[model samples]
Target chain A: MFHTTFYIRRLHSICGLAVLGMVLFEHIFTNSMAIFGPAALNGALEMMELIPKPIFLGLELGGIAIPLLFHAIYGVYIALQANNNASNYGYCRNRNFTLQRWTAWYLVIFLIWHVGYLRLYTKGITGTPISYELLQNYFQNPVVVVLYVLGMFAAIFHFCNGITTFCMTWGITKGPRSQNVVSVLSMGLCAILCLITLTFMGSYLI
Target chain B: MAEKKVRFVIERQDSPESQPYTQEFDVDYRPGLNVVAALMEIQKNPVTVDGKKVAPVVWECNCLEKVCGACMMVINGRARQACCALVDEIEQPIHLAPARTFPVIRDLLIDRTRMFEALKKIQGWVELDGSWDVKDAPIQNPYTAQTAYEISHCMTCGCCLEACPNVGPQSDFIGPAPTVQAYLFNLHPLGKFDKPKRLNALMEKGGITSCGNSQNCVEVCPKFIKLTTYLAQLNRDVNIQALKNIFNN
Candidate 1:
């Protein structure tokens, strides 16, 4: 059989949009509850627990872990192998190709720290309370705030640019004009995503 | 006939370590002159347009035809083999330079080892050995045979790579030609035995996914091979193969 990475690439793409994209938006919305005060933020967590443990765990592993692993591993493979010369060549397509890989690398570090701190170490694994106070305390650390902002930027860039790439790779956008439209849309989406993240982060910081 | 003057502005690098500079040469043009013929005329005289003595411009050629893929140079910003680049077909004061995608050996010559290495990675050739006989060849469908033959017409002249935005010193992406070879050989009956091997190679870092699908390759191929078609097909096939591996494992 051919290398599994080929399949992984497509799956990485699909999962990025279908699974991660959906989850990412929901996550920000939940975080956005910070504006309503800590109880509302904590309430969102309580509401999330309404889903049964077995099912939620299954969703976490099947929907999140597997897909994320494939995406990250295959992405690293791409980053290691990518030859970035688009700056010299002045090809927009090549520039996007190289940029996507670089963003993926940024996501590697950011995702690890984000997921590890929030999902694993913070709430789910250790059973710490997911509350507005927790976020307040978390934001007290200047270094943590910097990391979170940087992480948000990286994730948003990867997710947005990822949609653009998905459109091209799947032949959804063939013409240069169509590609330009998609790129513009993704950029717009990036701004929106970052705004939501900042809103959530800002509520805690201020 | 009055001496016909042909001008060449060639990009020259003195040695591997030296910086490059351009020098213009005016040579006596002959009838039916191609880029190579004009280069040859300049070679004997080794004199610049201003009559300054200089080393002869350097380049590589084998078949003196499009087949061998040597003599590939940038003529007017387009990558093509110089042997068949008729002087009359293009505009005057033709600018000649080494293919930008590869390291230049000297003036108008580049090391095409990248393409060869890519071929090796993809196992671009049939593995039939001394142990196999001609009678053991597999029967091929006529339509499939024809298409495969077309893909086989790639001269590896680096024109496609030169035109390709994804291929360069910074990229491990193998470009389009070798990927087509993988798809071509995999269609063969005997070659099916080695399909897994070829596909596995393509699944590597510089393999198929690296292609940005810019579609520039088809336009620049000397043979007009249907590279994107094979790439799309293989993209599907490689996915199926991955599913197969996962299920079996």
Candidate 2:
């Protein structure tokens, strides 16, 4: 039971870092195109849509879906088993420890809504490719805009914090000094990503 | 001038199954007095601040110095050795409690048997036989030996476990001390022969994967062991071992 668990845990980290992490960067960059207005955003989406349907399907399934489902499901199991004593311990890292798990829980809900509503349901019912207009229509709901803002923050925090842990998990940053440096860097990246994504969201409201 | 006094608030429990309660005491403030010395003053009197006689505060200590790792407790919300927690350094009205990660045997005495069991689980020693005269052991590289020596300083003090969020009544993590011990022994040339066994042990549930890398263990360790570094190295080792296991079978 545990032998496979060890591998699964490592794989979970790898999925978060190598797989989902890359997808998040791509996602944020693509969304950031909205800052240039609908035309630029749609043009970027059109470019992506040009990929062969089979290849796109394969990438979505193998690169995103399978790893993501495994990461999410196993992540929930790991989070549940955690004994978060940050309330008692109250160290900076301990607080981050608690936040990481909490963000994970939030992301599970947010992802289901974000993907199910935006990706599958919207496209399935409308019989149209996802476009800036479609996203605009979706975000017109005040509740969705609020939910997306919170969801974006959770995803960004989880991914950036996941990077620091991935480094430690792989022994990339072994010492306290190095780990601190990586942590500061990851936070910087998170701040930058958040700024960019928020700007993108703001474009829709205008 | 009036004599100075240091106050103490100790969490007390009568037995393993009993509820815990706090009792207050005042000890004569002596310069250079550590927490253990203050506790000793309380032990001698066995009286509460309410002016009622009570049972003596129970605790464990072998070496009065920090090396024995006995007498570890939560001092002012931090897990550390009471023998080294000087009264002058800490704020007055010191709060003392057993290291809650382990079962409290009494007032501040905790049963560290789980740590011992973890050490055993990791097989934290080299195998030896007395049937024949042993040959010369391999001389270790000085740098490697230094690293090993640093990790070897862990006294099985429950501080790491106490500070670890992953180690508790509800969690299964074996805590950081034993993980470092496994790495320490694996660093030995002879111990390397049994490296697969140690790696297998760490591969089990509540092994290395259970480490959330919150790093409170490194912060609280009195020995200042580079616990995170060793754990990271062990993480790499186990991954490599897992790959080897996959291909070998």
Interface RMSD of each: 4.3, 1.4
B8-65: candidate 1 lDDT, tens digit per residue = 8899987666788999998776678899988888888899988899999999888987
TM, every model: 0.65, 0.93
Best by lDDT: 2
Give the best candidate by DockQ: 2
Candidate 2's residue-wise lDDT over B163-213, tens digit each?
888898877989999988999999898898899899999999899999998
Output per-candidate TM-scores for chain A, rounded to 2 decimals.
0.90, 0.96
Q: Which pairs of residues clash in candidate 2, taking residues 3 or more apart in a chain or in different chains?
A: none
Calculate DockQ per candidate and list them. Answer: 0.18, 0.65
DockQ, prediction 1: 0.18
Candidate 1 lDDT over residue span A18-43, tens digit each: 88887777877898888787888989
**Model 2 - which docking category?**
medium
Error of 2 at B108 (Å): 1.6
